[model samples]
Target: MYTIFHAVFGYFFMLLAVRVLVRRPGGQLTPFEFVIIFLIGGIAILSTIGHDPSVTNCTCAVIAVGMVHRFVAMARTRWRRLGRWMDGLPLVLLRDGQWQLDAMEGMRIEPDDVMAAAREQGLTSFSDVKYAVVERTGSISIIKR
Candidate 1:
């Protein structure tokens, strides 16, 4: 019973921590961010399971965490606002050949990042790009003119 509560609390705590700390997508995570993620996961597991080495406790903890995750997923689907808040909305970083400075600053994105995405799309210059968006997944998307 206490294992279930601990697992639930740990799950939400990790979710909130990751949402606040990680801005880039998994594919783009730097080594530093990867270390942070691993450390957080380790801490969450230790805190959730405590000193219990019993198979029963481990099984219960796993099930509790899974159920909590499933519930959150379902709730997000049913609530648009919750989904938006948890996952975030797509942000425009560039528009009509101009940088959206405010949006870029808020997202901690620089022009170089946008240009790198553009270069990935075979664009050599911003003048050839019409728009750049930071997708909900933290991927930069470039629309070329």
Candidate 2:
């Protein structure tokens, strides 16, 4: 029915919006980012259900959305390019103690962020780090020298 169509559309729309809006992974989301996500999800749910308050309509919408999500996940797995497009490749923030300024800027990362990650890995000095990468999952990885 219309609910199913709305659910599929809303799912894709939200998927695209979240991919564009959220650069960091779920664990690293800021409070403001979390608020944004919640608000967006609420809006998507409202729009998808439209004026339907019936349990059947709600159940159907949920199932449609879940099936669409599962299909996309499977498609991404089968198609490497789709997976790469959905989840970007890892970025090198630092290599051999040298900062990749352009990559850092593009990713909105800073030396302090890299240093914080290094600190978490028990690296006190920049010289003690050999590589720093912004993983596709939006986690900063530090490699010791």
- Index of the highest-TM-score prediction: 1
Please give, for residues 54-123, the per-residue lDDT of candidate 1 as tens digits: 8999999999998988999999999999998888888999999778888999988889989999999999
Candidate 2: lDDT over CA atoms?
Answer: 0.88
C-alpha RMSD of each candidate structure in angstroms: 1.3, 1.3
Q: Mind giving the per-residue lDDT tens digits that candidate 2 earns over 3-114?
A: 9999999988887898777668474787978898999999988888888889999999989999999999999999999988787888999998689999998888879989
lDDT of each: 0.88, 0.88
List the pairs of residues colliding in candidate 1.
none
- Residue range with the least summed lDDT across 10 consecutive positions in model 1: 21-30
TM-score of each: 0.93, 0.92
